[model samples]
Target: MTQTGWTAGRSARALASLALCASVVTACGSASAAGRPVVLSYYNEPDSSPATQDAANACSAASHGAYRIVYNKLPSAADLQRQQLVRRLAAHDSSIDIMGLDVTWEAEFSEAGWILPWTGSEAQQVEADTLPGPLQTAMWNGKLVAVPQSSNTELLWYRSDLVPNPPATWGQMIADAVQLAKEGKPHYIEIQGAQYEGLTVWFNSLVASAGGSILNANSTAPSMGAPALKAMQIMSQLAHSPAADPSLSVQQEDQNRLAMEGGTAAFEINYPFVYPSMKSDNPALFKNFKWTTYPQVSTSLPLHSTLGGIDLTVSSYSKHAALARQAVLCLRDPANQLEAAVKGGLPPTLTSLYQNPAPEFVAMYPFYKDILQQLTTAAVRPKTPEYQAVSIYISHTLSPPGSISPASNLSSLTGQIRDALDQKGLIP
Candidate 1:
């Protein structure tokens, strides 16, 4: 059996034994009264900062002996993290009290009844206080299923020293890149074009910026048509352009960042993490780094950068559901959010935190306003239970973007997306 399968089986047996022991008021029940606090397990991706751990410690202390949180580190890769959570939740593992979920996983988890829904005052507070785009990520089927902690949006990073006036549109940017290349300058435009989640994000942003969406309002069918074709054509042209990265087909976000830091790329579309990563890796390169809202597809259209980030979700099977909810609120409190932003370099989800950022945040103030603007106007990916399969089909079909021709591939892309959503030929 798979590791997750083995874990689920073991958890089931343990829970069954605990249930029997509780019935007789024996060891299991006595352990609770014998100075054993109600332990809550929080599963999340690995983080280098102690900010999250510190916050958990603070919350545990504030619980007044009610509960303590035990951190469970998941794999850094998002797909792996989802796989681990899905297997355990599918088996109704009650030990999973709280979880850190990717924004795109919210719909899938909620639809599968893997997460607990937030309602009443908590829902009202989350809706009122968080940025609209990030808050939307926590909702599935018009109900809140998670609470956003930090939010991320892509920015167009450019070397201000090389290109003083960055291009405002994709056409302009490509033209400038081509000109720079002609001059024998080591400058190219870096983007995530690999057949992965990053490619889905880039495609969604491009389509949205062109005044279209990947799916219809209800996510029941493909809404991509002319706008999508236009976006794909743009992507194809850039991939084959003189200024295109040679390894664009396999490049992800980190590769894009590395290219920019190596001084080979004049512009890149990447998340906020790139800022701090650049600062620490090569201070000299960081000096020339600047960011702005993603370039528009056309002058008449507004940029709709894709939203990315994590959300704190409560497990449906958690034994201490109330305690888990309380811990979530504590973890997302304004003070904790600010601490995370300053110490961990994570952008805060609270809208007000951006308005009056802490001193550390202000030090990197050049990108602050643009970051907030992008977050406010961010475009979300398709919100559907079948989003994972849809993303896979979209990304795989568009791989090696250089060879894609919108006229020939649009229909196939749309059909495959629909088939994936319906589970027509895809493995269940």
Candidate 2:
């Protein structure tokens, strides 16, 4: 193992200190345990991998022997479903006191009352200091229902050697790609086009950067027609460029990485989780690579990237809701969060931790200072039950072989979303 500032022994000592400090101080109010072991069902993404087991151990220890964790790591879309969430809740009423949910599921989970609102003062303090994008995600309508465990946002990853100064416009992106290709290097740009969650995020950033909104004002009418067509034109141009396949486009980040590290491509738009592996996969190739905030459409604005991460919430029916809440507090503690970040590749949600990371954190990733700045500018997707359907429809239709024209598909998707908003009485 490459040496890092943190190790199991150091983490244990730090956590032990936190446990002692927390044990003497009584909770503001004694939350009812309701007579059961607190279970935390987590729908973990791959970015938070490896440390999943360790995180469970830390939460268990920090809870002061108040809860037992039931951890779940579902790696794909099939694993994230309403039925699965419902089934788990039905199986054991007292169990699953806490859950780690996706950003998009915040509204659905809150509306269903699957998770109780996060109301403690300690939680509020955390939320108060949170960056806008992530804070918005933790809320449903006006209610603060969840707290971000560790959030991630996309950024531009490019070869510093090939292009010391990255492109700042769509025109520049194409010109640079052509220049790089002419120089006997690979293509210049890479993005997710797959018919999955990644596609929704990439598309959202593209449209937003073009100064377009998906849902209409009041979120009650179709608003995506023209902007989407414009966005599609940009993507279609990039697709036909020498770097990408005109006949087929890889729709995921993994493929993007292959193109990037193999020197098959000069640029990649991806997340920080890919950093460690990139270094391991080809140390020489990425030794001078750069991961920075994406260039904006205009010189003055920051490129808007979507916030993608999970939140920890409590089950309303959990027999051990109080203990579950405490478990969340334990996980959010600076020491534990920092440790998790170093070991798990989780970006710290706590601003203090993000600003002044532990030594281990700094050693694990030197570019965290840059990463934190980009994350602060991240934007949250609309949090409504309709968002899921909107995202799925947009992703499916934009990818080739779907019958709808880009403009037509976008118009129809927004219409369906508006109908959902009206159904919820969010708009008249």
Candidate 3:
């Protein structure tokens, strides 16, 4: 089985056991919140396994017997966490006292009133500490609804030995790949272009590189135009190109392993988690690999990468909001952040914590500091309640090559999105 698949199986068994234990503990009529600690459950990605554990431990120490942590390790399904939240909301809307939300879900969860709003001192602190992309992502109609715990910035992972210098433009990237193909080396580039979230990431990156915004700044209309169409055309060309080694089936992790371990692709676009496995996966291969910022397309305007990250939030129905808030504060503390970074190589969210990362983290992921700067320039998807459906529109429209002509179809899609906004009274 794939590592992703294996992780999912293990998590299913673990959650089942935890559920039984939790039911037993609840059935025994545990002490009231006034006497016992306020407990909150959070769902997290498998890549964040160590971060969740370290964060929970830190929260426990900071809470000093005032709170406890419950983690739900999510499966590998594309929307597993989102679907789980909806299922939990249906059964008990307030059951999840504390939650973790992906930047993309800010709109849907906030609109559904599934997230609790931040207010007073905590609101100011969270806003002051968070990275702009994630901070903005956690907001809904100008209200701070969640705390950005950390951010995931996309970067280019390449075989330094294979391609000494990264390509500077889309044309250059293609040329580099073509050169590698001619040399009888493996494929040159591995991009996440599947029909899932990965596709959205690639799409956002391309649009940003082309100086096009995915959604209108006003958040009421699809902003796709000429630049966006150009980006789509670039992707279609890659998909249809005979010399291209990558297919539509590749995801981020798959691409990472293929480049880093299999020694096939010369470069892969992925997040920081892949760094941890490089040495163990193939020490010789890892020795020659390097991670760096996304190549500059238009240096005058920052090249945008899609923001992928998680935040800590409280359930709207939780009776433990006060306690959950306290725990969140603890999780955001610099000391805890440092500890988590040391334990898991999870990037620290607080700017101050960037001064000194773990030696191992620094050694394994030498591009850490550079990536921090890149994270600031990353872009979040449309931050409106209709974001999920909007994302669906984006994926469906862009997934297939030659499925629809971008120039014509995108105009029609824009009209359809504008109508959607008008129907909801967001725009005319």
By lDDT, the best candidate is 1
lDDT of each: 0.87, 0.68, 0.71
lDDT of 3 by residue, 138-160 (tens): 88888899887767777887888
Pitting candidate 1 against candidate 3, the one with the higher lDDT is 1
Model 2 spans with C-alpha error above 4 angstroms: 1-50, 75-83, 90-93, 216-222, 225-229, 245-248, 401-409, 419-428
How large is the C-alpha RMSD of every model relative to the true structure?
5.8, 7.9, 7.2
Pairs clashing in candidate 2?
194-251
**True-structure lDDT of candidate 3:** 0.71
Report how far off residue 268 is in candidate 2 (Å): 0.4
Which tens-of-lDDT digit does each residue in 1-428 have in candidate 1? Answer: 34688599769967876786768665675554744468899998787888888888899999987899877889999989999999999999998998999999999999899997899998888888899889989988888999999888888888988788999999999998998888888678999989898988988999999999999998889999999999899999899898689999999999998998888999998887788888998899788888877999999998898988889999999999998999999988888887887777778889888887777778744588888888889899999888888888888888888988888789998998888778688733
Clashing pairs in 1: none
How many steric clashes between backbone atoms does each model show? 0, 1, 0
